[model samples]
Target: MALQNNEKFDIKIVYDKFEAALHEEDDIHLQFYLESFEELNKFFTLMGTVFGFVSKDLKAKMDILNEFLKDSNKSENFITVKKMIEYEKQNELLNKKGYTSGSRTLLRLHRGLDFIQLFLKKLGDLRDEESTSSACREAYDQTLAKHHPFVIRNGAKVAIYTLPTREILLKKVCGELDNIQKAMNLLPETLEVTAVVHTRIEKLYTVHDLHRLP
Candidate 1:
């Protein structure tokens, strides 16, 4: 769909709704870009990741463009992400030879992946925080561990359901992580999970460390 700013949509309400969606673990808004600010947030992360993956150096420069776009910062020359992706792809095609795929298709793919990233982040964060116990089952559960039955007398004796944290991550977050890790040189398990989560969630993107990324 064509994009335009609809003044009727309140940015403040959308912002608050975005946070509340996280807190409440809702997915309706995540399904569609109903809120403009949130839409931008998702788009930015996707753009950042795609740009980041293609070249470490280029990612850093494009990030300046994103930082400038921040509403908190006063800046001139707003740029559309689509246009930026288009331009970057064109340059890549012109400067290089033996192209593997069309630049236009790649650009669209990156932008589309960013959209997927935004939704997954909101979706996964909801459960990781909300479903898992407080502080990810580290709080009262730890204290109450003594009280909880370590082993069942007769039943399954399930203290905590044993689940491969990575499996949950794959199902809920980015399936791409699983594929990339298996295909590419082995990355630290945590990095793989984090990469998956980063694509799906925003807080990870904001974090400082690349390894600690997400």
Candidate 2:
């Protein structure tokens, strides 16, 4: 697939979708969360093949949740994070592996979201001419690296070195901005909104004790 130009993506759209995903304070609307994640994937896409594996991994996780939403019999249970957990657990559907239940699938995506939130915070904190690869490495180490196997980590270590410096990456993902400084300025609000959605999902998994799902 051809990579979409950065002009086609607005970083703020990710923040907006995540903000909308928050429902009734602690609850998250599943559809909005999926949509926000889909938007966030564009950032990886815009970065080019260096992060293709990250984007592919995230898409696979989202596809699982979308399948749950498409099932007529179980669609109601998949409408919100809270509902999905209750329905899946009450039915004893989470005992199996390989994302056989909504809870398990969403847990994978939630971990990916944590990596993204951490990555953005690191990106926002970078000084001039710093390597974006370091931010990617640090974020991956803290989040997804824990859940991933040795082979995946080895692959990511190679990909990380191919990333552009902070200035170039900011321009690639934030092409709509007048300059790199404006893009840097946009990161705080972006991270703030994303953190709220991440925290809600994190709490949901914590409450259900689903973090260790295979």
Most accurate candidate by TM-score: 2
Model 1, C-alpha of 98: deviation from truth (Å): 22
**lDDT, model 2:** 0.83
Q: Candidate 2, residues 1-214: lDDT per residue as tens digits?
A: 2454435446667777888888997999999889888878878877888888888878888888999899998899989999999998887889854447778878888888899889989888887599899889999999999988999899999999888888778777767447556656677998988888888888888888888877
Point out where model 1 deviates above 4 Å. Answer: 1-63, 67-78, 93-130, 133-214
**TM-score for each of the candidates:** 0.20, 0.91
Residue pairs of candidate 1 with colliding backbone atoms: 121-200, 121-201, 204-214
Model 1 agreement with the true structure over 12-55: per-residue lDDT tens digits: 33334434323222111221222323333332233223222223
Q: Kindly report which residue pairs in candidate 2 clash with one another.
A: none
